[model samples]
Target: MSDKKIEAEVRQFTVSADDDGIRLDRWFKRNLPDASFNLVSRWARTGQLRVNGKRATPGDRVETGQIVRVPPAETPPPTAAAKPKVERPTLTEDEIAFVNEIVIHRDPAAIVVNKPPGLATQGGTKTHTHLDGLLDGLADDAGNRPKLVHRLDKDTSGVLLLARSARAASFFSKSFSGRTARKVYWALVIGVPDIKDGYIDLPIAKQPGTGGEKMHVDEEEGLAARTRYRIVERAGNSTAWVELQPLTGRTHQLRVHMAAIGHPIVGDGKYGGQDAFLTGSISRKLHLHARRLRIDHPDGGQIDVTAELPDHFAESMAYLGFDPADGDLPLDEIKFSETAEGKRRAAEAAAKSRRKERKGERRSRGNGSEGGRSNSGGGRSKR
Candidate 1:
């Protein structure tokens, strides 16, 4: 067979002394903006990358002031790309105020915001206002709309991370999927657990239901989940301050595991408990909060971010006699405009009215009219 040969364009660069023993992939990524680690390693494996004109491996140590040559492979032609048309939603006066208040830590890589309860991370069919929808308005710089790398339950408020770019999103997503990203949560449960500082190794499975899919702990046919918890304080006979670290990223893993151990979250309605609803014991809102996260930086470093507890969570802490500022918890300012507060109050009033209506029906039935509206008085039983 005739030998097919293609000439390679060799590019050379001298390594600085400071980068004496850095990984070859890292060094190439720093120098070549378009080349990724996979490309570098592939070229190295094919003897296309050399040190001092000798074939080199991707893991070879580079001494200071050594010349490295990378042979250029056949580069693919750039494909036609379209600029994404981003639709920025208009925020209400209250939403603008809320967005201005909740941002705790922000950088070019990621943004950590204090997500208030009742705000969904993404939008649904009936959801008009959501965190992702409002991100373009909350960005620090123009044309840098942030996007969520992960999610939090609508009722479970606290720290939420948003990636600034698609690159950052991919990097952070990998970090979370690999379990290298550290996530910590603060919660107030119904009762104190038996173990103060230990792990709950359980499995969670999606419960078979019609309305909304909820999670339940099923040891037999469920995915393995783990949560490490520690008791921060004991609050009366019914509530306890707790910190949780989820080892696996399952849907509702923490909520299901805590409820499975006889101590449900203060305001989780899906699980079986009296205090599940917001109108129950916890009056304010759900007690779960994502407090902190630690992640690797895309620029060869690590970043530690913390989001403060919301006002309602702080109120719960006060009710439990604990200081919110006792530790390094970041405090964020939240200002609910009068218009927003009015809407919220109206919603609550409507919910209360509906509950009263249901209660009235139950009481009316107690007055001895339960037998299908009494056929003696009805001409033809409306059916």
Candidate 2:
């Protein structure tokens, strides 16, 4: 490593409301553009970086009015090698037309595409022709290709958002990771759930021996996962069209959760086994569709866009005697505090409070202390 001298004075910044809820590394990229991510991470790892006088990590969220302390900025030598630029791949005419055909909405900062089923978002082993490979078709005159902010499953059809620039990508990425962006999905399940509308607070983990290609519910060593599902219309007791909202983002979360409840999503044979397929004229394609996306725009206001269902999903719905119009339900903003897990937490807290009260009473009786002053200055906190 080359010896580099750092400046003596430390830099301090107060978090702004606009930058609130963003990651610490992103904060540096926005305000201190000169500081590279490597430098910020190094500062954090070595305990040179702090937030509100506490050591912080790059993933830490910053709140408004919080003080962020940074070590002295490092200046690289003038003779340092310049970083190589990523070459943008040239796209064929057909590739550009294909990507453009899927574009349902486009703005200065974002591009919303109705990605069809069977198309992988990004390429992997044995996967070449994917959405990411063709993203060069969406590049602008400056050769800046739109960046994918979120991804959908290969067999899932829906609205996929893309950022037009690096700055927009950072902003949109923060919006998604912070869980401020809302996604509404429509799916057809094998059977109707007993509860018309309820939250599925089941933890999920990757299944063993699947090479991380599959997920399953693992209560012991799984990540907290929650999904809110509501039955839209039932075709007798056989099948039901449902609206799904994932409270937490996990790989194949909706598919895994539905299958765990004995009502697997239509055509998801990987998780649902043989029962995932339906009889009669119903199509065997995956019925899950990302119907709508509502997110805060970096340019201000909100970008609320809906995607039209694919031909297979639409055809399946028609064959199932369900109206396509019924799938266009309003997407409401939901809070975790209103979920079943939230209620359970509240009950536990109340029980703990009662237990503490009883313990205090017993102690007071044993000590014979009378006329104890009660503290009644409790104040509610606002999120």
**Clash count for each candidate, listed in order shown:** 0, 0
lDDT of 1 by residue, 195-300 (tens): 8877788877668673425878778976557787878888666688888877667778889988888888877767746665333334546789998888888877
Regions more than 4 Å wrong, model 1: 1-88, 91-97, 140-142, 275-284, 325-383
Write down the lDDT of every candidate, Cα atoms only: 0.70, 0.82
Task: Tell me, by lDDT, which candidate is best.
Answer: 2
- Tally clashes: model 2: 0
lDDT of 2 by residue, 65-93 (tens): 46788887666688998666555467789
Alpha-carbon deviation at 127 in model 2, angstroms: 1.1
* Pairs in clash, predicted candidate 2: none
The alpha-carbon deviation from the true structure for residue 26 of candidate 2, after best TM-score superposition, in angstroms, is 19
